[model samples]
Target: MLKFVKHNLETIAGVEIYPIISLSIFFTAFVLFTVWAMTYSKETLNTVSNLPLNDDESLTEKHNF
Candidate 1:
């Protein structure tokens, strides 16, 4: 398997750079997505993360004591 991979690498002149190029592309996409999410995503999503409530509210009808 190692020999086969070595032979293939030799046959493809620029294949060694492919991994670097792909990683760069992936990083660029991730950054773009993060920026878009931060700047253009829903305000509800942004506020939801910092909601005032820290506990769950019961669904039952409110009772007056």
Candidate 2:
């Protein structure tokens, strides 16, 4: 089965670039997320991290969930 699929793909022109494009997209997203996480503000991180434990009811009400 794998050999058949490989043979079919090999017969198609420009089919090989799919894997390269996929890897490039994944790498770009991974790098962007890493940079965002590294540069994120300490205050915002603390606020979101504590959201589940915060006792103030106003936060929940504002979302209109």
* TM-scores for every candidate against the unseen true structure: 0.50, 0.82
Which one wins on TM-score?
2
Off by over 4 Å in 2: 58-65
* Per-residue C-alpha lDDT of model 1 across residues 1-65, encoded as one tens digit per residue: 99998898889877889899999999999999999888874755654554544343331122211
lDDT of 2 at 26: 100
TM-score of 1: 0.50
The 10 consecutive residues of candidate 1 with the worst lDDT sum are 56-65
Model 1: colliding residue pairs: none
In candidate 2, which residue pairs clash?
none
